[model samples]
Target: MAKSGNKMATLLNLILVLSLVLMISIAESRKLGEEAVACDSVYGAEEGDTCESVIQKFQLGADFFLSINPNLNCDNFFVGQWLCTEGTVN
Candidate 1:
């Protein structure tokens, strides 16, 4: 009887720890979703707009814009170029 009781107690403790971890994960997921913002540009790139200018107007630090748009040629951005301004890359 004593051995059975000890086993039950250990199982309950394990369950409690698992529940706590699950709850923490759920809360963190919610927080991350709330913090995430959509990455869409309102205005298209105008004629003669450079990648550096776009980065500056969007408040992105140097290299951040290029990092977001890997296909984009930083030094050869044409007017009317569109790009994503937010969201996870992968």
Candidate 2:
């Protein structure tokens, strides 16, 4: 009857919410693992430091800089941000 249909819909909604939570948890775990990088050297950003400036100062290749700092957004980079001058992504 109507009551039974309502119960079924509620149960389905609960299941859907739980499934979404599980998916989010899995995605977050994977992201953490991917972002884990071990740094041999680090550099703190100063005023007027662009990605290019940092790379040139350290004599680093563009590709190498990107590899070490996988999550870096060059356009929005801020002063006081610490970057890996030498590192390996795990």
Candidate 3:
């Protein structure tokens, strides 16, 4: 009986932790979406567009770009990916 109770408690704890993580993830994603929507200026990635190229084209600092596009995976960036070129996300 004690062992069963322990297992149940562990399972409940896992569920609670997972729920909190999921809630946090959803909130973060919503925040990022809001920031993207609030962007005053936007840019689309082109075939040969690198992060450096985009930064140079838009005259943005690397840190600023990262700050505005928190979800951007520069290493895995693809064509047609929209970026916030100017925004209040800073």
Highest lDDT model number: 2
**lDDT score for candidate 1 against the true structure:** 0.70
Query: Model 2: which ten-residue window has the lowest total lDDT?
Result: 28-37
Q: List the residue pairs that clash in candidate 3.
A: none
In candidate 1, position 61 carries an lDDT of 67
Candidates arranged by lDDT, highest first: 2, 3, 1
RMSD of 2: 5.4
Over 1-90, each residue of candidate 1 has an lDDT whose tens digit, in order, gives 999999999999999999999999998767453333345554577877777777777787656566567676767766667765654444
Tens digit of per-residue lDDT, candidate 3, span 1-90: 999999999999999999999999998767443544357788889998888889999999999888888888888888889988998652
Q: Each model's number of backbone clashes?
A: 2, 0, 0
| Per-residue error (Å), model 2, residue 45 | 0.4
lDDT of 2: 0.89
**Candidate 2: segments with Cα more than 4 A from true spot:** 1-36
- Give the TM-scores of the predictions, in the order they appear: 0.47, 0.59, 0.57
Better of 1 and 3 by TM-score: 3
Question: Residue 63 in model 3: shift from native, Å?
Answer: 0.6
Ten-residue segment with the worst summed lDDT in candidate 3? 29-38
Measured by TM-score, the strongest candidate is 2
